[model samples]
Target chain A: MRKDSRGFKIAFIILLSVLVVVCFLLGNAKGTIEIGVKRIFEVIMNDDGSTQRMIIWNIRLPRMILAALVGVNLALSGAILQGVMNNPLADPGIIGISSGAGLFGIAILVIFPQHQQFVTIAAFFGAMLAAFIIYLLAWKGGIQPIRIILAGVAVSALFGAGISGTLVFYSDRVYGALTFMNGSLSARSWPEVQTILPYTIAGIILVMIFAQKLNILILGDDVARGIGLNVEATRLSFTALAALLAASAVSVIGLLGFVGLIVPHSVRLIIGNDYKYMFPATALFGAVLVMLSDTFARTVLSPTEIPVGIVMAVLGAPFFLYLLRR
Target chain B: MKNDIIMEVKGLSVSYKDNKVIDCIDLAIEKGKIYCIIGPNGCGKTTLIRTMSRSIKPQEGHVFLSGSNIFKLKTKNVAKKMAVLYQSNATLSDATVRELVQYGRFAYKEWWKGSYEEDTKIVDWALEKTRLTDFQKRKVNTLSGGERQRAWIAMAIAQKPEILLLDEPTTYLDISHQLEIMELIERLNKEEGITIVMVLHDINHAARYADELIVMKDHKIFKKGDPWTILESDVLKSVFRVEAQITKDMDTNKPIFYAKKVI
Candidate 1:
């Protein structure tokens, strides 16, 4: 077991390095200019006010970094929620958390367009609200995974309908809302990266710190309590942290689906279920998965970018089905 | 009353929603004794154990551990004093036996700390005690029912508690495996001097293993005494509603009961 885990760790680190190189090259090379890896690195180092340099620094780098951060956040949150809730299928998007944030994002965009700064905060509250409702509705003695998932599906539909209603009602300001609703990394900028950075760092740190607790949590609540965990309190705090992660990502990247659902599951398949390793492995792999998907989304069609969400869904759905089959 | 009691339940009544599962009852568990609670299904044996372990809060009354109210103590402090093993050892996350047993050291660990030498020593001791040393690296899900149950016991033993509470520890095991677990638990009580309170479904097993017997009927304690004294034909008929034949084991001097039919 020890040797197998150590092997997985080494392989994961090598994979992450390769992905970083690939992500940097794809982000810098493919757009309109088609710069080489050598030129991209030179431009980054020299900064001679050329078009390629401007594109690399201003547009592609920020977008790539945002995608990586958002992916890590979503994946870590998913891993934590799956452990705490003891549900393999738990994810921010599928469990109504992202939709709740999406509704709040739309509300801010439509109703209080001037107060754009409140979107992240509102999204956080909205995510927590959805989680609270799902948990409360699922509570019949205790929250079972099946009950919570069913409640989440219901809550997702409700909030999804609310988002559509807002979009239809405010058709005048619909263009930005339309693209944002589909989960895109298009035209992502430094400001968006800045918005999610603090929360993402803090949330990831908190998840790592509580990784051992999460390991205990997956043992079921009774066992968790038996091992000295304050089960309810640990669960509540972990749920809130997961909400914060998904809300932070959703606020920046719109409603990206399946990144949270699939990344951790795949990571677990490779690294095993010990959360101490699973947490970091999932975060890195999630970043790579999204970076590669975003690279595909932007370059596959070239000059006309598809939503990264579409790319993720196209790739993730089949993998999810395969997991179910297994 | 206070001299040798390791655990005390006073006026404990537990309910679920509108239905009371465990009516008002009191129990004092002496140190280094094996106590078994036996009753029919849904007669509140598990509920009483759950309440005693602080997994479920009683609607009324207090459980005192070493003269302190257990509910008022921090969870880690309580865990240091007592460990519980419920019936189901199922988990969504699959772990090796070593990893599962390592979790028992959570109370002694800080967030940033990894396993210390002391933790490893305790975990090793637990694995040895449960005879799981060879299976330490085996995945828990792949183990047979008896081995998996022993893994759970190893985890509880790893906690190194003075008191251990088990809810239906031998429910689904084969007779031989059940005897194995009972002997292991008895050794813990006798050699390690750990106070054990367990809910067992089999009356014969309880009579053979337990130093003291608690017979529950209709959500209340019908009788509590030494198993040799309490495991009589009349007591079994009245409390268990079974026409029973009671005899003494010539070798061990313990009561042996054979139930003919439900009365």
Candidate 2:
């Protein structure tokens, strides 16, 4: 009999928004050369191209922005996947989508070095292919969550093997692929930020605009159809959009893990599954989570960094188990 | 003649995995009446109802709504004319009853604008009509079976349809809840003038609520008539394989049946 209180959801969103700002600032301040807010503002307000300014402007700022964008992409994609498949466990990272993107992304980088510019497009195609194969394998007239997850695990393993085989064959290029395979945020600058921003904005807008469809979809396909939805068409469009969002994020971050699973699931656990609020809430929470997790990844053993994907998995797998048991 | 026949099913047949579930069936639905299709389990009663609501695509033949092919019309247009309620739905378990009912206004939503005061009024009206106004704020899964059924009915009626289709609407309810649902269906037909087409497992409930009874057996219609003529002992034993004694309800003067051993 628990009610979905609008005030509670709006207030929680406000709290998450506040957390996003806090995460950004924490990420900005904590590092080898820790700078106070006043010093940071001083550099921003008056840039004389000093060492601190370079550290803030060239390194920390862009990476933080990229982290936030990845957060938005993964969280929104996860939200859509949960709706499209009607399963809570449908994360891009866990469901072979990231593996698909990684395999295609690495292939573009190492195998076809000349056409490396089409890496993002190749990654998207791979992700779509992975999604289609999973759907084909999992479908017994309808998408069951367990079947999809099992199929995803198999596809993910297969793609992981493909990535491994590619690296061994092209062993000379393994150096660059290491950070990518672990989804690190080290040394990424403005170019990475620029690569991910447009996709994030596009994914967010589309998710908001189609939020109502997700709500209708939760009512089951037959009822959704009876209520005038082109049920099959809606499912296809949303699934593709989910894959595209996840692929674009992976194209930039290269196999980043579990912002999808953790952020959206936690948000829904708080706000419930009305996508109108859940999408935006999940987006904001995602920004906070990744920025914070990246900060933790960088600072937990300062000067010696851990990959943010490791941080996310250490946090996510346990939470996933908790949900499964519940 | 065509105008009075609000929906016409012509040579409609549906198959599942190459096994025919619904044989070619033809029936005409007159406007502003309650019709019930009754049969044993797996007799294609559910399939026929689904086909009529366009939930299932027939393998052959056409279903015409308002003398136009239903398949040709836009989905929203069909939804606006007819609304179907199912016995079970893949509901977001946490959704509030009011929120679920509000989704029924989906067809009226434009590309730009979402909702209006008019929609709110209709939603509230639906909640009131279903006697679920008090429970509208509560989660759907937390409600009792009867209350949940009413909530679904509220959502369906909120579509503001001229025709309503329900597939085994009271199959899972207790006897008291079943009576409540039948009375509610009767009210929706009599008060709102909504043409009702429902599939029911309970013959007595159908005999009481249905103005016309369509008895189905083995994917084909066994008999079709007014309940008084259709609920006789011979038809019941033939269609249901039961020795059913027909009786009259003392208060409502409707035909009721008591069935014993199967044939």
True contacts kept of 2: 0.72
Weakest 10 consecutive residues of candidate 2 chain A by summed lDDT: A1-10
What does candidate 1's lDDT look like per residue over A1-326, in tens digits? Answer: 36445676667757776876687577668776788888878988988999888988899888888988998999988998788777788888888999999899778978898998999999999999999989888888666878888998899888888988988999786456666666899988899999999988897788778888888988988888988999999999999999989999998878898888899998787777888788887888788888888878988887788999998888877876786577
**Which window of ten consecutive residues has the lowest lDDT sum in model 2 chain B?**
B86-95
Off by over 4 Å in 2: A1-3, B1-3
State candidate 2's TM-score. 0.96
Candidate 1: misplaced stretches above 4 Å?
Answer: A1-3, A324-326, B1-3, B112-115
Taking chain A of candidate 2, what TM-score results? 0.97
Top model number, lDDT: 2
Write down the lDDT of every candidate, Cα atoms only. 0.87, 0.87
State each candidate's clash count: 0, 0
- Overall local distance difference test of candidate 2: 0.87
- Per-candidate TM-score, chain A: 0.94, 0.97
Interface RMSD of 1: 0.9
| Residue lDDT tens for model 1, B151-172 | 9999998899999999988889
Over B1-263, each residue of candidate 2 has an lDDT whose tens digit, in order, gives 34488899999899998889899999989999999999888999888988888888899999999998998898888988899998777575478899889988889898978668989999999999999999999999889999999999998999999999999889778999988888998899999999999998888888888889999988988889999898763887887787877889999889989887788
Model 2 agreement with the true structure over A1-326: per-residue lDDT tens digits: 23368988998899999999889988998899998877877887788889999888888888888999999999998889888887888898888988998898888888778886688888888888888999999987567889989999999999989988898899796555777777888888888787778888989899999999988988888899888988888998898888888888888878887888998899888888889899999999999999999999999998899999899989999988998888
